[model samples]
Each structure stands twice: as structure tokens, then as C-alpha cells.
Target: MKKCRASSRILLIGAGVSGIAAATRLLQNKFGNVQILEAEKRIGGRINTIPFGDNVIDMGAQWCHGEQRNCVYEMVKDLDLLDFTGDFFSGVRMVRSNKEVIPLELGQQLYGIADMSVPKGSNAEAESVGSHLAEHYWQEIESQLPQVDRALATEALECFSRHESSILASDNLFEVSGRLHLEYEKCSGDQLLNWRDKGYARFLRLLMKVCEDEPEELGALEGCVLLGKKVVKIEFIDPDKVRVVCEDGDAFDVDHVICTVSLGVLQEQHERMFSPPLPAEKVNAIRSLQLGTVDKMFLEYEKQPFPDDFVGFFCLWREEDLKQLRCSDFAWLEGISGIHKIKHQPRLLLVWIGGPHGRRVELLSDKRVLEGLQWLFCTFLRFDVPPPQNFFRSKWFANPNFRGSYSYRTTRADELDTGPSDLASPVMGGDGYPRLLFAGEATSQSHFSTVHGATEAGFREADRLIKYYESCKTNR
Candidate 1:
């Protein structure tokens, strides 16, 4: 453990995962004065879990990606709260638009081909994933795929592309970085872990528990969180002090401030949220890195419709569906990634949608969403199915606080990966001391967009402050 004697009152903006982590660590390090201000009423920002019929459902972030290898997993595994939901089955059943079921391997094979279409190195004329795949793999697909299967392959690839784009919460493949694109860092173990009935928000509880267990002299993590306190402006008062003003007219004066607002929030409010304006480099970085939306729908069934063996169903767009898309201009249902059967709960299904479609669907009423689901089931199930008993749709994009789901690598940030690093940098005062620091999932280079990324970023900034104080003591 690192020790520092420098006494400074710290203020944390945003009660998200990053803010929580930073607060806990600072308290454990014997920081006497620290407080967290949250825009939302709740402590967990993106981690929201709500009660449903008999079981609980996670409406926000559900999975702990990278399983045991994830820092978050290590922190929560012993809590006896998580259920490992890695692929229990080898693959899912591929359902064509014509209600025909084919071997799952075929769909995987075609998706593999499409994924390999982009070459290893950057091209002078960067192209979107959709365009690159069409240009380079169209001929190969035509020759390799049977004439009857060509259309199905095309539809499958389209769904795959949209899913990939949504994972980064990007608007489209075109906007994503084509040159040296940022790729999610994958751990060696299973890539996903479900939190059973406990929900992902339990991680916040665990964090609080750790803080409470600290020695009394180290300062408890108590009385540090203030919700519904939207920060309006942050200003450097002097080399050693900063003032934070909230929308509610509450103001806090602190020796240091850590801003852990999301990239989406930063993109929307960075200019107005800071006083004296952030440096040009920081502003450009905030504007360049895009924030994207990936929304989810939970459909509850009174009676289970599909077989227990069925894991999920992917929609293979038909010519008629394509025509309907042209006619309605809102046939995003055709791009449905899949309706996943929630493990352990046979009556619940999870559907994930991304990009424009995800945002559009969020506006639809439960009745309207159920109608779309009915059409989808009737079209793909080859039989009539009862309407879902309950329905839930996430509107992360519309939420003023969130603005969007997560960060993405944009073409504007392709030339340099400095965007994230710059966003993470501390704001310096005339005395050469950092009065403000920024952290979030977007600030992490390798782990951006993951829960672990946010946690690690918080630890990084906390450690930086600790080291700064340690250096000051030594120099004295």
C-alpha cells in the first residue's frame, strides 16, 4: 500500500462505477474529506436492476465480460452472487425468414468470412465495415454460397455487422474508425458472466462493503454519496482548490476534483460543464470519440413458447421483410440480433437491438413493442404465439444523464489513440498541481466500454493522486 501525508478535500462528480471506485480507494487511503455528486437519484449509473414477476432482471449492464479474468469478476466472485452463464450449448439455431431452420455452423461460417473481409492494415481510402465486406467478399460469397443461400447469407451478415456496431454503441460502421480501429481486449477465459438474481448492481454493494471494513482511522466510505446533484460547472479556484457547482445551486469547494461522467455526457456538456474552458486538446478529444447506444428489451411469456433446447433465434431477412422495411422506414425489427432465452428462467426472453433501431424502439409503447414482437414470432416461429405478459425497453439514448450507452472508436479518432489518454489527463493549475482529474470507461485505452475499464480508471487516478502527495511529502 502507498502512503501520503498530504491532506486535501476531494470531490467526485458522478456516482457511476468509476466514481464509486475512486471514492472507496481514497477513503481507504485515509483521505479525510471526500464526497460524490450524482446526476441520477441512484448510485449505480449504468448498472440498473429491477424486480420483475418472480425473478429480477437487469435493465442496464447485465454481463461481466471476460469472466474470472475480469477485475470486476475477481472482486465479486466470492460474494456467491454470480452465475456463470457462458455458452452452455455449442451454438444457437439459425432461423430463416421463411421459418426454415438450418445448421448453426453455416451461419457462423458465413459470419466468419464477413469478419475476415477487412484486411489487417489500414487503407489510404478508409471504408466502412459494410462497404469493405461488400467490395472484398461479395464475389467470394457469390461463388462459395449456393444461389439459394446467397440472400440468406447477405441478411445474416447484415445482422452481424449491426450487432458489432452496436457493441461499440456506434451509429453505423461508417462512423467507426477504419484505420487501426480500437478492438476490445479479450480475456483468456469465458467472455460473459450473468449475475443470477443478484443483478450487476450488486457490485456497488460490494464496493461499499469493502469501504466499511476499512480501519476507522482510514475514514469510512460513509456520508460520501449525494444523488440527484447534477454538476453544472467545475472551476479551478486556485492551484490547490476547485469549486464545483451543481444544478440544484449546491456548491462544493475541494482541494481536488475527479470527474467520472460518461463519454456521452462529456460529448454533450463538456464545454458548458467546465469554467474557463478545458484546453483545446481535451475538448477535441471529448468531441472526437463518439458515444453509441445499445438498448435491450425483456419479453416475458406466460407460457413458454420454444423448446428448452433452443438457446436463441436470429432473424434472416426475407425479400418481403426488405420490402416492408422500404415501406415503413422503421422495420428495424428485421435487424433483431436475436431473442435469447434467459438461462434458468424459461419464461423470459432477452432481445438486444442497436444503433438507430435501438433508439426508435425505445420510443414505442409496450403494446406497440409487443405487436412487433408478435409479428416477429409469427414470422419466424412458423406458428401463432401468445403475446408477452410483460415488456421492458431501455432508453439509454434518451436519458438526459446518460445521453447514450457507451463510447466507441470513431474515424475522427483513427489518426491518434490520444483521445482517451487526453480525456484521462488531469487539469493543471498555475502552481503546476492537478486540480481536476477525469476518469471513465472511455479513459481506459485497453478496457474501454467495460465495467472493469471504469473500475481500473478510477484506481489509476486515485493512485496518481496518492503518488502526487507522496512526492510532495518527500520533497518537503
Candidate 2:
């Protein structure tokens, strides 16, 4: 393991999972004078937890996805945080546009067919998932299947499209690259696990606690985190030194700096955020990756309106209707993939809106959002209910700090043959050493769009710097 010079200064940008993880790891490695600049007043970055009534709700990252081998999952287990299994597509009530409920069995069958359409073999990367599935259905149209079955199949595909798109937080299926969609590295086990009791913020706090060398050491590390330091520009003084200037006029000079900002932020601010501009290749790579949005609406009521056993509902739009209505219209509810009933809080309902529509919802007034939700529920349930007593919605896309919620594999960047690797590479200084390094979820090839991915990237860069300093000391 490489150990950095005790006197070398390190500046970490963004106190998100990656920045926090990097800073803690560097401290443990005996690197001193490490400073963190956070745009938000709080730590955890995208992992935000807010007080709601008697319980805590996670406005940002809510799950430790994957199973046993998952880095974040393992950490959750190590901390002994209480978690509950999340069943994907479970207890979903698929309602038709005509106000009819599709048979659960038929919905499941169509979903299975859609899943089977995804090529498991080598050709998987050669085409997009949407294209592949569309071809399958087109072939089915010519097959011996009854007209009724074919119509059902089409509806099922539409339902699947809405559901999966929301899960991917993608605008459309055709925009996703085939290889990029299915070939991501996976850790074995369940796909989802919710932090039931304390929410995900506990994990961030726990990481800070565990990274301390001694009881007093934690205080020193905590003191290093500077909140509300919105970085406006990074000026490279030389190959070995860089200066970070904040919006508030504060400046930080350090030996090495790691930027763990979101891809969306990079896209919006990269041209102005760096001195002498970024390399064309880096700029191209940044522009190539597509950032997506997934906004959450938490509806809390004073009374329960649905059955106690009902966990979630999926409103399936008629294929013909969906086709006629352009996605650009920004009919927010049409983009709602599902509504999940909070297990612990029966009065709470979580609605997921994704793609461009998700951002549209952010522009709406609270009353407007509630009215939209009321219409969706009344139309699908064939009944009316009282307005929610309280509600909360996420605005990750609109936030200048985030710009968008997550990253996705896109068709745009294939021309340059660049992906996360290009984005992750360090900007080399004139002295032949890495000066500005990048670390974030979007930069992780296998785990892009995941908290664990960001955390791992931060640790990876920190280790690199540590090793470089250790090598230097040995040579001397």
C-alpha cells in the first residue's frame, strides 16, 4: 500500500459518498491536512435523509442494491443496520387505461416474455434492448398466437417498458445501448434491500465513525469537512499543485484533488469550472454519457386508503393511447411507473416518476402535484380519495449540484468508443504525476449509478495517491 507524504495536502470536492469515503480512507492511511468542500450544508451528498412525522425518510439513495457480494450491502450488514427485502414487480396491480385491472397472471406472463427477449448470448451488445424486444413482438405478430393474445402481449410490453424505464431512470428504451444495458457487472444475491428503520443516512454516519483512528481523531476528521463550499473553479497552478476557488471567495491549495461531482454537474459546469478547459477527449467523454432523472413523490396521509396487504400498484397505459401522446408533453402521471405503499407506514405511498417527465414534475406547485396524483389514483382505482395530508418530492435533476439523478449507457458516446473509463482517467500534470483525479458513480464502469460504485472509486483514487507517495519515499 502506498502512503502519501505526511505534509502533502489533499482536497476532496463534494462530501457525497465518494468524497467522504476517500477522505476517511486517506485519514486512516496517515495522510494529514485532508480537506473536504461540500456544496450542501450537510454530508452524504445524494444520500439524503429527512424527518417525516415520526419516521425518517431517505430522499436520495434508498436501497443497497444487489446481494451478498455487493460492497454497500456488505457494509450495511457489517453495521447491523436493519434492512428488509425488496421484491421487484411484486404485488403490482397493473391497471389499464380503460380503468380495468389486467389479470396478475397475464401481466407476469408478458413480463416473462419481455425478459426472455433480452439476448443472453454474445449478440446482446450489438443492439438495444428495446429494438430486440420490438423485433420479438413483430415476429410474434406473424406467429400463430391469437389476436387477443397478441394485443395482450403488446400491452404487457408497454407496461414492461414503463416499469423498466423507471427502474433505469431512462427517458426511453431505444436510447439505451444494448451492451451497456445488460452487460454490467453484478454482485450475487437479491437485487434490492431497503433500509427499513433508520434510513440510508445512518450508513454515511457509520462510515465516518469507522474511519477514525482514535476517539479524538474523529473530531479532527469531522473538522476537516467544510459545508456550503460550492466550488466554482479548479485552477491548476502546476503539475504538483492545484487551487480550488469556491463561489464564496474561499480558496484551497492542495497537492492533489479528487472531484466526485455528478456527471450532470460536469456536463453543465465543466467548461467554466476548470482552468484552460478540459482535454477535448475528456470533454467528449463527458458529453457522451447521458445523465437521467428519477424523481420520487412521497405521499403521506392521516389514514390508510388501500388494503393492508397491498404493497404496490402499476398503472399500465394502453399502447394506442401512449403512442398517440408524445412524451414531450410532460404529462407527469403518464410517466409514473408505480406507486409503492410504505410497509412500515401504511399511510405513506411512494410514487416513482422518471425520464423527462420527472423533471417536469419538479416545476409544478405542491398543489398541482397533489392534484395530479389524485387524478391518477381516482382514474386507476375507479374511486376517489381525499388529498394527501403531507407530501414530499425529489428535485435531483433541477439541483445545480446534481443536474440529474444518475448515469446511463447511451448511444451518443459510441462514436468516440468512450465510456466511464475516459471519464475516470486522471488529468496528468506537467510533472508526469496525476494532479486532478475523478471519482464518482458515473465513472465506475461496472457499477455506474450506484453509491457503492462512487464509494469504491473514491477509495481507488486515494489508494493510487497513497501508493505514489510511498514509491517516492522508497526511491529517495
Candidate 3:
């Protein structure tokens, strides 16, 4: 920490998970003069949880999502932010196309592929879960279930359809095309309990706790980090310095700048703001990286049209009818942790939409989204339900500041592999002096689109700057 603490300066952009994590490491590393600039009033970008009734409904990320062995698990454990074991499939039910709801355990056939340990069978071909869905049929899945229980067949089909429906934003499950790049699908599944039981309003307080001002002579992640400062302009001013102008008319002189803004923010606005303009390759990479959208449609019904014990996942079939409704974006929303607290005459019914289909879904008015949702329910649920007296929804795409749901993805999964290779590399300027350094998910090729990926990328750039200084001293 001491070796690089003096004469070290870092400018971090955005206050998302990755940013905070990177800041923590920087402070610990004793990197001096680190300042983080966030556009929004709060941090924790996508991990947004809102309070409702007796429960807290997650607005941004509802699941501990990804592989259960995800790196976030370690982060939470290290931060001491976990309490429960963090399983994802308790109190689960399926809403079938026949409109009949049934318990999923009575039909384990639908879940076998999801929790199957043999991922190499599905992922070795570089085929995506969408491809897996394409090749596998309902009969094959249902054949694994008990035929004696008629509800088994109904629930099995509905659950499979629901999985496809949840991930691909396409109206049709048949349209979800891609190779599965991620074999480890266990997202830490239980971070912050998928709710703001502490509430989203209080998250800022947590950020303030760990991410506060550092001491006069602190180590990494220390006095280097500051909040409420906004970065307005950034460019390579001299051989060793990258100049940054903030919104409050303050300018910073730093060795490097790590930008981690939303894709929607970059795609729509990058052209005008960047000095000397983005290189053609950078522009192409930016264009090639797709920013998807996912809207959470929340409804508070006056009366529970569904059963009391039924905490169900709704699915549209892979057939033509499901394609027409655009419900095939993502897969399931589980009740294992049961953060929504939908027990004993629950009040909320929520759905997620992602990908290009999610982008279009955001275009519709609340009335239109609700109608589309009802149409989707009718297509899969098989039962008729009345209009909701209270409904709430999120449109991240329309918001210019956000632009889309989160991260970037395309059918070509390898391109989605963003790590150090993908992120821009910092090199010496005209006179062999370190000019500019950039860090973000897009800039990283190995671990892009991930919280840790972004944080590690920031560390990588900081390390690069330190090495550059080491080289200069050795040569002298």
C-alpha cells in the first residue's frame, strides 16, 4: 500500500457495484487521490429494491442470479452481508397455458435441465440456453414427469415455456437464438436478500459507511474516493495526465480515468462528448456491443384471482402463439428466498422483460404494457383475470440517463466475453509518457458485464499506471 500511495491519482466514473468494489480495493491498496464521480444521486445502480406492503420488491435485480458459485457470493461473505443459505427454489409453482396452476415438485421434469449438473452436455457446443430450448421438446421434458398426476403434464409444459419466456425478449420462444457462453449459471442468488428490507432508501447509508472519505495519509480505497462530484469532460491533455472537468466547474488532473456508465448513456451520447473522437475500432466495438432492456411490470390486485398457496412462474410456449406475444425474454422468477412475501393472499404479480424484445416492450404506454401482459397471461395462464386497481412498471430504456436494462449482449456469445482484452489499454503518449487509461465492462474482454469484472478492470488500470511509474524510475 505504501509503495504506490504517494503521487498516485485515480478518477473513477459511476458508482455501480463494480465501481464500489474497485474503490474498496484502491483504498486498501493505498492508492492516493482517488475520486469517484456518479451521475445519479445514489449508488448501487441496478441493485434497486423498493418497499411495498409487508415486503420489499426488487425493481432492478430480483434474483441472486447467475451461477450459485458466482463471485458476488464471496464479496457478500467478505462484506458480511449475508444471513440465509441463499437457495432459489422454495415454494415454487407453475402457471400453465391451460390457466391451471400446479406445484412444480409434482413435475420435476421441467426443472431437471435447469439444475442439471451436466452443463457440458448443453454448453460444450457453445450453444446457448435458447439453443437448448430449441432442440428439446415438451414431450421429452414431460416424459420425465409422473403421468399419474395430470397436473404434472400441465405444470411441466408451463414451466419450460416460462423459462424461455423470461430470458429472450422475443414474443416467441422459437426466436431465442444463441450459443450459451456462460456455463456456470449460479448467480450468488442471495445478496441483500433481494429486497430493501433495509429498503433502497437506506442503501445510501451503507455506501456512506464503507465508501466514505479517507484519512489524511491513508492506504488504497482511502482518501482517494470522493462522492457527489460529476465528470463533465475527459481527454488526454499532456504526456502523463488525462484532464477531467466536473459539472461543478472543478477540473481534475489524473494519470488515468475509468469510465463505467450505462451502455444506453454511451451509445446515445458518446459521439459529442469525447475529445479527438472515439477511434473507428472503438466506435465499431461500441456499436457491436448491444445494450438490452428489461422492464419489471408490477401489479397490485384488489383481489387475488390466483390461489393463495400458488407462487407461480408463468411461461409462454415455444410455439407460434407464444412468439406472437413477445413473452420469451427470460426464464423464471423463483420464490425460494420469497422476498416478495407473496404468502397468505399475496398482493403483487411481477414479470421481467429483456433483450431487443425488452427494448420494444418499453416503447408501449402503461395501458399498452398491461394489455400486452394480460394477453400474455391469457396465452399461458389459460384462465381469465380481472384488471388490477393498482399497477406499477419500469421503463429503463426511455430514460435517457439509463438507455436500456443493463449490460450488453448479442447472439454471438464470444463477443459478449468482455475482459481485459476488450477494454481499452492505456499506453504511453507521443513521448513515451502514460497518456490515458480506460476501464469498464466494455473495455474489459475477460469479465465484462459483471460486477467483479468492472472492479478488477479498474484495478488492472491502476496497476498499469503503477508499473509505468516503476519502469520510468528503472530507466532513469
Candidate 4:
């Protein structure tokens, strides 16, 4: 078994968290010939951390979603890499587009209602999260609030929906499947655990076993990964062998291939990239599952405007205001749900944008984005805000490598009865062995759209191969 495993060649496509995790586990299990081919010049797929302003900022993933059962938290908890400062919604200041400051208590109250209104578990009666939330939240507002406050609460609900849209990576909550949304199990403990100055790249370092004091290096997983190796095609050359071709004309024939690319990449390239084509079910699953775009714009000011404790300003645009501004050039600015303070970088503000607008913003000039922000702050916060010294925004949607930020279940997925499980299933070769395996955050059944989910998915695929080899040994 040891000889067989050592002699086998395994190729992992993409150097994201999933690919790295798979490589780490395979190497640990004595799969000596394992190699990772990354599309981009750098590793850490969507977990990109770059130097900005005074300290580092995570352009991709910034938080450890949970503590208990979270692979990222468990990996770095003892190392003191986690920060639990500032509640996500505690310091929320809801200001309407008309510059009316809603009472803190009222804002919190409406937000709480909206939060709880989202259906949980698989038995939800509503088809979509938006439908369930809309019916429930409006009911609560009508019953609980005064006539005057009801209209304001309705606007607040729209703000809450936009925030939810960013979180779910959906254009609108109406498209999100109510039952499938509940399928994602939340880990116990702090949900928005920050990495502070360290950023999410630390997780990649930890996965590679890179020491904190030492200069950041890939360590054991150093030579195993080849960057700028965009996998153009994956074909089963024979029953026991697979061929992976790269954009640079590099090719490798391996015993097995583990595909850890993003669902967005799969959706875009699966048809043309795979030889003999993927199964009908697999294709349907890819089409059904949506990869939503959630983009962030970071602005660094020379002088910080808000207090140290100020978390964010939730922008609630009234229906009438939206109607008037619908035809404006800066209409896409309406997609910005909130402008929040970055925890470690106090001088920086993080703007959350989602859906088609997120993609639209990416194509706009930086000057235009700044101008839009100026209009937004002046309108919502009633301030003539000066332009920031530094501005950085994520282009995940525009980036071919990652078509969007993450995956989310949609009503169509529910209707089609296709999901991560269907996408995660392997393509068995004629030799009765799994020749091509899938692993990513999208492949995670209960933990999709999370770093922990991607980690677990990688481990699952690696374990599957390990188990297959073990069974072969036993049979022998």
C-alpha cells in the first residue's frame, strides 16, 4: 500500500484553500508524488491578503466565520491568530437616504426581527428566503410599530435585505432558496472572528506549516505548487490515467486528479475544459448552483472621520428615492449596503456591494467610484466627505479565476433537486477507480461559502483517495 501510494501521481488543480488543504493532507498521508497547479501567479485563490495603508488588508476573506468545528479557527486558535473585537451589527447606525437618523433602539429592533425572520432548517414553508423574510418582517412591523414608524421600518427592511444579499452573495434574497439556505450549519462561538493585522493569508501559511517568526514561505508545500499553471483541459487518457493540460502548453499525466477550482470557474469552463464532457447531472448541478458576486471597496483616509468605536452606517434608501435615482449614472451606488470601519485598520472604511452592481462597479473608473462615494456619504450621512488617500476594491467578478466571491443555494437549485452533493460526486473511470474528484467550498453540503467548508471538502476528497488505496491493499 505504501509503495502503491508513493508511486501514484496526483494532480490538484487550483491553489486555493481547498487545493492547499488537499495537498497538505495527501502529503501527510505519504502521497509523495502530489502536485498543485495554480491558475494565478500567487497562491491563496480567493484568500488574497495584500499590503495596504499602514497594515495589511484582506481583499478576499477577512473573517473566521465561527470557532467550534471551524477548520480555520481550530487550525489557528491556539496560535493566537484570532481577534474577537467589535460585534458585527452592534454599532450599526441606520441613516436613511433622506438623512434621517433612525433611533439606535429602533434600528436594532428592526435588524433583530429581520435576522430572526430568515427561515432555519429544511422544513421552511416558503420557497425563497426573501418571501419568508418579507412576509414575516412586515407582519412583525405592522404588529409592533406605530403607523409613522412603519414606513421607516419598511425602508430599514430594504437595507437589511441588501445586507443579507451581500452575506448570501445573492443579487436578491428572493432568489435564495429558503430551505437550502438553512442547510448551511453555523459553527458555535464568534461568527465574525477577525484576523486583525495578520489577515487571512496567515491561514495559508499555517496550512503550509510556515512558522510565525520565520520569513513567510510555503514550507513543506513549497515545491509542490506551480503557479501560472492555468489548467486549460482535464481529460481521462485511459482507465487508470488522466491528462491535465495548462494554458502555457504544459501538460502532466497523472494517476488521479483532484479539481479544487471555484464553482464559478467550473460553471464558466466545465463544458469546454472537460474531455468527453461531464455527466448531465453534473452539468445540471453546475448550472443550478449560483456563484454570487460580493465585492468590497476599501477607502483609507488621512484623517479618520468617525470615532474609534463606530462600526458602520447602514444606508437605507427609500423606495421613492430609488425610483428617482434609478436612471442616474450613479444608480449602481445604491447597491452599497453599508460603509463599515475595518477593525485593525481604523483609518480605512469597507464598503459592501453585492449582485450585478458589484460587477458593474468593477468596470467603473476609480475616480467615478470616489465621486459615487462622495454623493453617497453626503446624501446618507449629511457630510461633505473628502476623498480618501488610498482606495482599493476587489474585482472578483471581473477576475476570470474567480467569477464571483462565493456560492449560495438558489430557488432554481431546489426546483432542480441539484446541489453541492451532486457537484461533489466523483467521475469514476473504466478501471472502477475515481479518476477525477471535485472539492471546493461549493462542494461542501453543510458549510458552503466558507473557508472551513473548503478545507473540509479538500480533506474529504483526499480521504476518499486514501480509502480507495487502503481498500486496494486489503483486496491484495
| Candidate achieving the largest lDDT | 4
Candidates, ranked, lDDT: 4, 2, 1, 3
lDDT of 1 by residue, 77-173 (tens): 6767777776653466667777897677777777667767653355423755556766766766766665636677777777667666766677777
TM-score of each: 0.90, 0.92, 0.69, 0.96
Candidate 3 lDDT tens digits, 173-283: 333224223422334444424322433323333434434243222233344445666666777776557787877888888866667666657677778656767666556
Question: What does the lDDT come to for candidate 1?
Answer: 0.75
lDDT of 4 by residue, 1-476 (tens): 22367778999998999999999998998786999999899999999999997799998888899888888888888988889964655887998889988888888888988887888775463579999999888877767764646667788889899999999999999999986656888898888998878899989998899988888678879889898889999998888889999998999999899999888999999989999799988898999999999999999999777665556799888888888777899989878978888777878888999898999989999999999888888888755568899899999989998899999998998888899999999999875688999999999999999999999999999999898786444221
Runs of candidate 4 with Cα error greater than 4 angstroms are 1-3, 86-88, 122-125, 146-148, 471-476
Cα-lDDT of candidate 4:
0.87
TM-score, cand. 2: 0.92
Cα RMSD, each candidate: 3.9, 3.4, 6.7, 2.0
What lDDT score is found at residue 107 in candidate 3? 43
* Candidate 3 C-alpha RMSD relative to the actual structure: 6.7
lDDT of 4 at 74: 81
Off by over 4 Å in 2: 1-4, 86-89, 119-121, 137-149, 210-220, 319-330, 472-476
Candidate 1 vs. truth: CA RMSD? 3.9
